[model samples]
Target: MLRIAVPNKGSLSEPAVQLLKEAGYSQRRDGRALVHVDERNDVEFFYLRPRDVAVYVGQGIVDVGITGRDLLIDSGAPAIEHLELGFGGSTFRYAAPAGVAASVQDIHGKRVATSYPRLVTEHLAQFGVEADVVRLDGAVESSVRLGVADVVADVVSTGTTLRAAGLDIFGDPILKSEAVLIRDERSDAEKIAVLTGRLRGVLTARRFVLVDYDVPGDRLEEAIAVSPGFEAPTVTPLHGSDWQAVRVMVPRADINDIMDRLYAVGARAILATELLAVRV
Candidate 1:
């Protein structure tokens, strides 16, 4: 059976489970359950802290894990990012007192506070700056006010936390992070591919909708140009000899514009429906 590690708490947990469930895998109903076995799929899920997920997978304790890209890199484990899961998005950056430090070089010879000390240290090295790294578990933004550090390099989601602490982000982001699937370099390839494919399908389903419309046979070519799908739109004969039905997948963001274009090209009975799940 394939063993998978999932974040047990924090921002990625709920969405991770929801995605798995949407992909037709059974999830543990009890939040505290350490492990859940999905016998039908021949898989086992191990609940773990987000930071430790990459390590567990890298050590061969679990076949693969779902964790934030920042956490995965900070751990420095022997794992490869199998796929980007696209949630828990944030930026790791350097911030300091609004009018004090204007760039990363300004923090040279100064102390910087952060939960991710390794990431901060490595990034600073690239700029030839050597600043003391004050490691804090949380509330890293407050370190500057409290005099624990002159600056901070930490996660910035909306920058609200940085603003609340009277800090301003400066310099280019150290890393742009989001949730991702990680696996040991030598994990079971076939099994991992299966799970990855399923998750990919669910993500695709969430980002697009099925579009169906009918067009006069004479105008079919024009309408097809407007809604050419992932591969090609499916065309079928309609009851009226002079008309045809077309089915295609449209990205959720482009649905309205595609609809208007189809309408302008002599299409009718246009419909868009959300996809529950998909394999292709």
Candidate 2:
């Protein structure tokens, strides 16, 4: 059976679990359960801390795992990213009290506090600057105010928290992070491929919607140009009439605009439906 590691809690946890469930994997119903077995799928899930997910996969304790890109890099684990999960998006950056620091160079020889000490250290080294990296577990934004550090490097989802703490982000983002599927080099290739395929299906389903419409035969080319789908739109003749039925998958983000364009091209009976699952 393939063994998978899941984030037990934090921003990456719920979304990761939901994605697995959508991909037809068994997940723990209660938060207290550490291990979940899916006999039907021949797989087992081990719930661990988000940061530890990479460690387990890198050690070959789990065949694969899901975690954030920032956490994976901070851990310096041997595990490699198999797929980007497309959620839990955030940026890692250097922040200080207003104008206290303006650029990466200003951080040189200053005390830098962060939950991700390894990531902070490496980023500073790339700029040829050195600093005392003060590692803290949480509340990194408050570190400078509390007099523990001069600068803080942490995840920035919005500038709200930094503003509330009298801190402002400085320098370019150290890393753009999101939930990702990670795997060890020793994992079984066949099992990993199957799991990756299922998750890819779920991602595609979430991003697109199925559209159906009827268009006058003479205007078929115009309608197809408005919503040409993956590969091409499916066109079928409407029995005994000078009309055609068209089926296509369009990006969910542009559904409204596509519908308006189709209407302009003389297409009627246009309908858009959510996709529950897709393979391509």
Best by lDDT: 2
> Could you report the Cα RMSD, in angstroms, for every candidate shown?
1.1, 0.8
The digit string of per-residue lDDT tens for model 2 on 108-164 reads: 899999999999999999999999999999998889899999999988888889879
lDDT of 1: 0.92
Which regions of candidate 2 deviate over 4 angstroms?
A: none
Span of 10 residues, lowest total lDDT, candidate 2: 154-163
Which residue pairs in model 2 clash with each other? Answer: none
Which lDDT value does model 1 have at 78? 87
Task: State which candidate has the highest TM-score.
Answer: 2
**Going through the candidates in order, what is the number of backbone clashes in each?**
0, 0
TM-score, structure 2 vs. true? 0.98
